[model samples]
Target: MSQSIFILLILIPLTFTQSVRGKDCVCDLKNSDPAFPEKKLKNVETSALQCTRTITSEKMTDLDRLMLGLQQRVKQVEENVIVLEKEDDRNLYGAVSLRIIELEIAEIQDLLNKLNRTTQNYHHLSVQPAAQLEVMKDKMAELEKFDNMQVIKTNRENERVKRDLEQCKEELNATTAAPPTVLPARCGLGRVVSVAGPRTYSLTVFTSYTYGAWGRDAQPAPGDENKYWLVVLSTSNVYGNFIRQYGTLSTLLLGIGPKDTYISSTNPTTNTIQGPNMVMYGNALYYNCYNTYSVCQFNMTTRAVSTVALPKDTGYSNKFPFAHLAATYAYTDMDFATDESGVYVIYATTSNFGNVIISKVETSNPPVLNQTWSTSLHKRTATNTFMVCGVLYATRYLDQETEEIFYSYDTKTKEERFDLKINIKKMQTNIQFLNYDPRDHLLYVYSDAYILTYELIFQ
Candidate 1:
């Protein structure tokens, strides 16, 4: 019976141990149930993945918007660069125009300064005139005190002196009335040895026209001896279509008695004057024709216009102007000069390599080019030129107040001289026009609106 009881206890303990192991196995299996905590963990992982995907998509969209804005900014910057470039080009052009205007202003200022200096000189002379007037009054008072008895004896002596003066004046007048000595046909006055005083000076009526030509007619008709002609470049200081004639020097200085002869009412026409280089001779005006390499002659009596074409390849229209270091006189490619011989046109030609070329112009109905002369001197080097006894004299800028006659070319002997040191005293900086008047043996200078006359002394 004791053995049976112990076997029972062992069986009970085995059954208990089996029950504990089974229960533990059930608890472990519950943790791995599909519909329980495992399913819940899978749903939570899906939710987190969806949230991450949404956030990534939104960030990519924001990056796309930022790239688009950067592209627009780049386009705007390119457009601004283009506008700036155009503005820079316009500014550069404006600067060039301003430079030209500045040069013109400087020229005007120089002219004003010259005028001021002349006024100051006149003021000094005027003071002397007043002082002289006072001295004359005092002399008159002293003369009045010495009258009465001295007066009768003085009158008798004066009458005797007057009779002797009258007899002497008659003899002197007879001698002075003798015929003048005739000169040679070509070089009538001979070589110019010296230039004498600027005997006369006057301002033009239109002083504002800074460039012009004015002088007495080189070959005037019988009734027009005292007549003077003027051509003021009324258009841009370059062109005019009229010639002004004054009866006398008094009328010219007074700006009265001007007879305007219009070559053409419409300027820049076929017969209009193109530049300041002009001459009135034989009742005709000779000048450069508008827009042509030719010379035009307008007869005052007949109102006829005649033109003669220059040589082939003749430079004109500012091609070969009177140039110097300081400035250039534009459209002065053709210059009309007259001397004892006749009218001549001074110009340069491309075929002659820009050297001075001269041609004689016949003063007939249709003026013809008679003879052509070429010189080695360059046209641009000369500031002005004139003809004297068939000799071409070229002047250069020496100083603001002086011009040097440094070169001459004689058509008679084909001689060239560069050593002539004859100097011209100038009242201004530039001589816009210069011509030698054979009638009075005078040099007519039109310089910055002042008309000056200098006598020529010939050997």
Candidate 2:
């Protein structure tokens, strides 16, 4: 009985403990602080991170090489383009000369095409091996670059240039008969008025050289044998000629020529005089020798010679009979003009007041002086100031001074005259410069054998 009671007590306690564990196994281990301890995973994580780093590094290296290759390719392309451009320019050396060569080539090609063969060279028309190769290369290269339309366009441009060259040559050849260096009417020109019309201009130049006389019964025609001729050449649009011959030294218009070379007479043309300052007026070839200043008109339409009055001197003749520029001088050198009034011929004469005298030819009495203005202001050269709305611009020379001064003459309310700050340095012996072209309001100054221009800011 005692053994049975003891077993029952022990067995009952064991059975109760096992039932609690079976009901909640995790809850039953409440006495333990942690269910599972933290683990150590260093090796696997470290290896994966290292692999990622290696992949990034390899990608960076590959990208650098790709960039380098791209830069080299671009540089190579640039160098090749530069070389090609230089070769093109080298091929075009003396490009203007190519025009002439092209003409010869075209003619040769025509002949060769007709005969189905090329020609052999002669002494005058010889071709070297190198020359032939160069021509062939140039022609083939240029032809390859052109389409059919481009070829036609190129041909047209060449033909136009050729035609222009011929016309320019013809005009240039005609000037051998006269001495006035023909300049193209361009931007740098000042207009000197001729009573012939509005578009006429004055030509100013210096020339020298002389002969004793024209006819048989002449005196020892005198002055400086040093040869200087100051002339008043007039420009006229009527005859398409530059000089109308307002006045000249005795020789140029009346010099001895081929048929009458027996010391008979020396005259230029037998023409007629038309209008004032003898602008655009041509003369018939004078049969006999006479004074150059005594002239008349030559008409292109009617083509006749009529007498015009011998102009009263616009003074300035103290040291007159300008010996040097006898047959070749421009009339505008001693004249004044404006768009409002026609023109004024000013001269410092021996008889008249040294004050300015004007020829008002545009009035009722065409030959009379409209008004006599006596502004006794002195000038450097014998040339006078042209007045526009009472403002004056005159060229003058001081006897002892080296430079020619341009005087801007104006008066205050009390008629007090003043000068301005405009001047040009002409200190040298003067080798033919300063021409006036009205087409452009400027002066054509030739200095140091180069053409320099000054524009007239007309006030």
| Model 1 Cα lDDT, one tens digit per residue, 313-366 | 999889999989989997899999999878999999999999999999999989
The estimated TM-scores of all candidates read 0.60, 0.30
Candidate 1 residue 373 C-alpha distance from true site, Å: 1.0
lDDT of 2 by residue, 1-459 (tens): 346545654433222222345556331112222222112123334544554554453334333433433343344334433433443344443343344334434544443443332222122123343454455556545543433336656887999999999989988988765745533221122322211101111122312111110111001123322121222112231111112221121122222111211111212333321111222101121110122322333332344444322234533212221112222222222332421333233433334443443333221211233444545553223333444333444544333222233444332121424454444444333312233324334344332222233434331
Q: List the residue pairs that clash in candidate 1.
A: none
Q: What TM-score, to 2 decimals, does candidate 2 have?
A: 0.30
Q: Largest lDDT belongs to which candidate? A: 1
Q: Measured by TM-score, how close is model 1 to the native structure?
A: 0.60
Query: How much does each candidate deviate from the true structure in C-alpha RMSD?
Result: 44.6, 31.5
- Judge candidate 2 at residue 27 and give its lDDT: 18
